[model samples]
Target: MKLSGIFSDGMVLQRNAQVILRGQCSVGGQTVQVVFREVITCTDADPSGNWEVQLEELAPGGPDELVITAGEEKLVLRDVLVGDVWVLAGQSNMELPVRRTLDRLAEEVRGLDLPMIRQFVVPQSYDFHGPRENLDSGAWVPATPEGLLGFSAAGFFFAKKIYERYGVPIGLIQTAVGGTPIEAWISEPTLRRIGGYEATLEQCKDDAYVQSTKQRDEDRNGQWYARLNEADTGLREGWHQAEGEAAGWSEFEVPGSWAGSELESLRGAVWFRKEIDVPVKMTVGEVQLALGTIVDADDTYVNGVLVGNTGYMYPPRRYTVPQGVLKPGKNTLAVRVITTHNTGSFVRDMPYKLKAGGQELDLRGPWKYRVGAVTEALEPQTFFHYMPAGNFNGMIAPLRRFPIAGVLWYQGESNTGQPAGYADRFQAMIQDWRETWGIGEFPVIAVQLANFGPEGEQYTDWAELREEQRKGLAVPRSALATAIDLGEYNDLHPQDKKTLGERLALSARRLAYGETELVASGPMFARMERQGDALRLHFTEVGGGLTTRDGNALQGFSVYGPDGTFVPAQAFIDGDTVVVRQEQLNPPVHVRYAWSNNPAKANLYNREGLAALPFTTEA
Candidate 1:
């Protein structure tokens, strides 16, 4: 007899809920007996080897053992407990591990030791054949001092806060992947009920077609990576040394795009070489070579040796040069930048230096640059992982029978491009999850899309996507955890996961745990009314009246007339409300607050310190 990994030792079963134990056994028919404490349940394995036993509801608190017997075979599970379980689901933000936030959370991870917190991260997989009955592989892990690094930071801190407050063993099922859209998590039936995916579903239903497409994608991606690897000049030629070829190269500035150089509007690799002298006195202690940020991709080298390589753009390049890599003499710093399309160059306003022994060596100046092979832009790889319902079938279907306290979701960035049907799809997904889990009306706390990209941009899909996330509240027992003030302007994976987790825990306290007094959510724009030449906006969840987080005057409020033109407006607090006005509009048709990709300075907040949800009051 073999049960699901979720039923193993050190696992936490849901409290005050019916426990359904399921598994597979020998093909020959045999009765399986499950005994826990005073409760006992039994079921017979079918000819196909499926078996399950519905156990009675259990209360909180347990450090007991579970014994199962099937024919002559028996399995025993130890160190089991009864507590609250929550499903952690979403994209990169939700999948950001604890180690990524270690710089900020290292002390917390080292000190906060609670063995009651556990997690089982589902291995990434996708399937269109149907729901998978078993996960690829996963095992329950306690929050040991060394194991905390493996847990999702958001889920870890969330469970930690809850466990600290309520003293309950917290079990988290991490079902998330990076760069995935919301549609990937919804079931096929749910997507069909909502429509618009008829063609996608048709293609999905074909087993041969699905398998062929997936295989083609894998082969194509493998070839692409292999080609790039071969084309990496830093790996083939030791051009980072002063002895390498550079006499024929031309001098070009280092801190700007190649577009500014003679090689304008070119793609592919551009090799840069800079020779510098380093003293032994400066290379003694901790040393680092900062290459700022590169466009597309880059592979940097020092003194004929490869120092570091960044797979893609966006991450700042900070590579360690090792202890004895730098000698007391002239050294070469070479960088091979690869751009599939558009100009490849170094980004400005970032650190470009070599630091050692508390001394800095500026690396921003003229350097010899030469263009390598140029090629047309590569076609985007097919994302079979983002196909509708495939992720749900492989990642979530196996855990449907496991009872949970609630769900913590952080996604919607990928769906920002097409926000038209997001609201309906989001609501349907929530309903589908609740129905499939066999839990009636479970609470779902969703983290709204955070501010990113250019601040104060007049037009963008981010705000619209946030609106769709908010609309999900139309479904019963759904809440939004606003993060307008916590986003990095350039980073989609915000490192401030502690705040995200805490905010989610607040929602759980109110929506899931029924804590009425807790200030669970930020203020939402309830309604707007015309007050002569001004507009008065009412807000919900204004605990202790409205106040700014920075204690400054209101920011990010705009008034628009019927002409559809908007202008910045002055706002004032009016007893749990905000009144806005502009000199031009005698009767404003709409009022928008914090409605942009990055409302950098938006300061409206409740006295409880939660920021207001971004909204636009319609005409």
Candidate 2:
């Protein structure tokens, strides 16, 4: 008898719930016998050669052996345990491996030796034909330095907390893909119920369109890169200054996107240069140059010397120049920004300075921009994995039989594009999964979107997205991990995953295990009461009452009057409620807090050290 890999040795069965063991046989109507501690079960294989047997709940300790027999084909599984199982699902933030965060969590990772905490990572795959029933292959692994390195950082830390607290085997099933939207995770049927995704779902089903598009993109990318390589002006004209500058370089605004200002619909390598007058005193030693941020990718140079290279747009641009690379009179900084796609440039509202010998130079305002080579537009990548129902078919469908405690989801960054009506779609997805699992109201803890993006007056996209996540509270047994205070201005993959994991466990403690007294979340804006000229905002889940993370005045509050214009408002704490008011506005129609893309310093948190989520009273 061939069995599913999850039913192999070293796997953990869910405690206090029926555990379903499954596999297949070549012959139909075969008798499948499963033997476990305090339980023995038998079942007949279906006509299609599929068989599954459910065992009664077992206690939380094990190093036990499990035996199964199907028509004289005997199999034995060793070192099995009974305990809580949780599925951690999301995008890159959820797929970030422990090794990626080793710089920060090294000390934490070294302490891991818990064999009780096992993990099973669903191999990343996508399917459009139909929802798949069985995974190709995967094996359960113990929590070790080598093993944990492949596991999700957030999931590992969360499992460590749960295993330590409960002293039970914890099974973490990590099924996530980076840069994927929520629609990709939901099943086709679920997407059908959610309307707006119908078009996307239908397109996913079109085999001709999918294959043709893929081929076209592949051919186009091959041509563009091949052509650019042959006629790279950046190399021919001595652009790197490190590689070497061309004459008459065009001028463009520094710390801004080049697509809108300097180059429109531009792709490929573009060289940037700025002349800085270094003082004689500061030139005695090496200096660190901060270029703020660059889009797509970049190779930076100082006085024609290679300093550093940064790939991608999310990280800040900081390169170190050698001591000899700088001179007293005039210093040249050349950066070759390589954006594979369209819309490339240096981002604004970031640190752009050169520091040396206790002296600093601001590298902002004007910089000469020149085209290295304008490559043909690269076709958008066909993300079959991000297509509707694709991930669920390949990753989630096989886990329908394994019972789980609950789900800890750290997604929604992919869904921010359609924040206005995501609540219904997300809720529909929750219901569909619950229905598929045949479990009633299993708890779900979703992390709210963290602060991000450049400085802007209005943050309609992400703010509305946070509101949708909050609106998920309308569902039963759901909690949210508000990460408003945890995001870095330049980095999308923030390194403070420990707090996020701990926070997720806090909610799981209350929802999944009935530890109801635990203050698992930050203050949530429950309702507002208009008192005189001010609005008194009441909150929910404020453990030990509300207080700012940094002990100071309340900030991030804004009020809009009858004219529907939002203005910064003065806010202060009063008992458990926060009273907000602005001198210029009266009879406030709406109030919002931390309602921007990157509310860099929006320090509104509860005494529990959890950041209060962004919210708006409007609609």
Candidate 3:
């Protein structure tokens, strides 16, 4: 006899619910007995070697053991707790670990010792055929300092808040992968019903086609990189070394994209060099070098030695410079960047400095750069794991038998490409999950797409995606946590996960824990009224009445008349309502707030400090 991998040591069973224990027996028709808290339950294995037994409702408390036996085979599960279990699902933002958020939330979790909070990191896998009966590999780990490094940042903070408030052991099932779209998380039947994904799914199912695509991608990438390395003059002449004079290099500003510059259309290897003067007092011990974030890949060298390197972007580039790497006088820093796809850029608004012994040296000025090698842009690879229903079948299906208190979803970045159909797809995925789990409408706290893209550049697609996410609130027992104010303009994965987690926990308190007295959400658009020449916009969930983030005039409001021309309008908060008007135009026929991709001026908020949801009053 053997139990499912999920039924193991350090696992948490759902409290106050009839949870099922599953396993397999070699001998068909053999009785499998389970014992927990003096309660014994038995079930016979079928011809397929599968056996299942249900336990009575268990209360919240444990560090207990579970015993199961069939014939001469016996398995024991130790240190199992009984409390709340939550499924954490989504794309990269949801999969981003606590290590990435350390720069922002380090102080909050410095000495945390919440062993009661545990997480089961589901190994990343995908399948095109059908749902998986069991996971290939996974284990339940507690929230120790070391283990917390791999825990999902958003999920960790949410679990921390819940455990602190209710004092119940929290179990998190992390099943998320980077760069995956919403359709990839839905079931095959649901995707077929929704349509538009049949062709991709069909293509993914063919073994030959998948193999050929992967092989082609490999060959293309290998050839491109090989040619670039061979033609790179910088490598032959030792451009990364400080001994080189670096002649024939042009001045380029740091922390900016190569777009609109001489290197805009080029795709290849580029080398950057910078000089800095260090004080003797600051070079006594090890120093910290932060290059913010880079696009694609980069290999950075301090002085003449390689200090650190990062493959691909998205993660902050932080490296530790040893004591011997720095000198008392002038030092040279060189970086070799490789642009595999898209534009090569050093993102703005991020830390670019060297810190040591409480001293800092800013590394954000013009640097001399030279083209090492130029080549064609690398062809994109087909990620089969991102195919529709692939992740759901392999990752989510295996966890269906496990009971969960609720779900925390932080996806939508990948689906912004086609924002129009996101609402239907999102709502359908929610319904599909509930039906598949055979659970009544459990609370679903979804995080709306946060602000992204360059400032002043209107990304209507992202705004439409946020609106689509907002529509998910129409489903019963669902909550939308507004994140417009919590996003970084340059970074897709924002560092302010603490505030986002707090917002999600607020919704969990109200919807899941029955804390109706709590204010869970920000101001939501209720209705629009045209009074005389101006328009009056009303709102719901005005916690403690309406207010503004900045104590200034209302912004991010626009109006359009019959001509369909939208102009910036002056707005003011009057009690719980906002009045908007544009003096130069006819009486406004439609209105919208914070509709831009990066609405830097959108400061409308409630007294609780939660930003108002972005919305438009059209149709």
Candidate 4:
């Protein structure tokens, strides 16, 4: 008898909901009995040898074993604990690892020894069909140093906070794919119901369409790799022969895009080689080479020894060069960069230096470069492929049988740029998942988008998308965690995940764990009243009172008079309310706080040292 893919030993079931047990049986087998806490439920197998049983709700606390008996065979699931279950879904920032954050990995890992916290990651997949009945493969593992490495960094931290406070076994089911669009995660039926995505889903379903897309991606990938090989060969040949054909080389900055520079908007593979002198003391030990960041992909070699390589552009610029690779003098550093789309070069603000032991080796001088190939048209590479029911079928459907308390989500970055349609799409996804699970008003908590980007640039659709996320809380039994002040401008993946996770747990504590005194959110804009020339803004969850994070004059507050012209306004804290007034305007109609691509130095905060949620009084 073969079991369904999702069934395995040591799996954590959702504690207080209807638990569905299912599997495959041999031919002619009529019945299967599922026993939990001495209760036996019998169900007959279908003609296809598939069987399912929906068990009654179990108590919250458990150290029980589930036994499924069929004829002469018995399968016992061990060490099952049930408390709360959550689904952590998001893009790259949520997927960013703790190890990437500078110097906090060891301490974070040592502190994250929660035995009751477990995580199950859905393998990346895409399907055009309806939801599948089972997952390809996945299992729940305890949250330890070894288990947490590949886990979603934000999700792990969020679960850790919940487990510490709740004292119950927490199950985290992660189903996020990096760089995936929101449409890809939505169910096909929901997309069709939404109407505009019919053609897109139809294209996804057709085998011919998939084949053509795959072919185009393959062709593009092959051409790019070929160009990279050619550049590497050319650099190797030129370096070996001591060639000095540097007359035609153009001068360019070390860490800026070549599109606006001398390279003149060329894409594909380009080879850059620079010669730097390594002191005698530097040659004996391992060296640190900071190439900053290169567009697309880059392979670096020190003295012809391949030292480091990066597959994508978003990772940091630091790379370790092995010891003995650097000679005493005239060490050669060759970098082969391949770009699938757009111009190629080292991105600005990235560090470019080579440090050996304690000495810094400057690598910011002019270098020689040559273009290997140029093509008018390039094929598109599909690193991520969308399939029918890929995630819903493989990841979520398999766990439908397990009873869970609720779901927590930290997604929407990928969907933020598409402001026009994300609200309905996100709401549809939540509804679909809830209906499919057949659970009754299971608690769902979501993390609101944090503040990001530069100051004073308010031409962002992200603000609208955030409003959409807030509106999602209107769904039954749903809550939102506001994180407006926890984000950094230059870095999309913030290292302050600890605070973000704790805040998320606080929301769960208040909404799901029956905690009443917890202030889970910062000040949220409740109402705005016009008082003469000033707009008096009222807020909720003002734990202590209204304050500024910077302890200075209120910044990030802007007011627009009836003329619709916005200007910087003087804002002051008046007890629980904030007053905003600009001298030029006799009447202010609208007010916006931290409204920009990046709200740098914006310091609105609650009395609890938490940043006030970003919002606007305008529609």
Q: Which candidate is the best by TM-score?
A: 3
Best by lDDT: 3
Q: What is the C-alpha lDDT profile of model 1 across 1-619, one tens digit per residue?
A: 7777677888889998988888887755888888898678888898877888876778777788889888888888888888999999988888888876654566777766678898988788888878888764677888887778888899998998899899888999899987789989999989888777778867877988877976887787677656765765644665656575687888988788777666666656778999888888767877789887788788788877788999677666878897887878788888888786656768765678998987888999998887655655655666777889989998888889888889999989888888877888888898888888987999999999888876767765998888888877899988899888888775666667888889999999998787978888789989988889989999998988899988889999998898999889999999988999998776788988888889888899888888899988862
Candidate 3, residues 265-316: lDDT per residue as tens digits? 7789999999889998778877999999998789899888899999788889
Clashing pairs in 1: none
**What does candidate 4 score in Cα RMSD to the true structure?**
3.5
Model 2 per-residue lDDT at 541 = 78
Model 2 clashing residue pairs (backbone): 238-244, 239-244, 241-244, 241-304, 242-304
Better of 1 and 3 by lDDT: 3
1-619, model 4: which lDDT tens digit per residue? 5555445555666666777777877754578888878888998888877888887666656667888877776788876776777877756766776666543444767656566777777676666666676666777777776776666677777887777776777777777767666666666677678878666667666878777878887877777676656655455465422235445645555776787565656666677877788789877677788887687778788777788789877776677777666778777777877676667768655468988868988778678776655544355565433433345655566566666667767667766677766667767877877877776667777877777766556667667767777666667777777667777654566667777788877777887888978777888888999899999999988897778877899888889876899888999999999999999987889998777656666787887777776677865
TM-score, cand. 2: 0.82
RMSD of each: 3.1, 5.8, 1.9, 3.5
Per-residue C-alpha lDDT of model 2 across residues 246-315, encoded as one tens digit per residue: 3587778888876555476777888888888889887887688888768888889887788999867765
Sort by lDDT, top down from the best? 3, 1, 2, 4
Q: In candidate 1, which residue ranges exceed 4 Å CA deviation?
A: 37-40, 61-64, 107-112, 218-236, 241-265, 272-294, 302-308, 314-333, 342-369
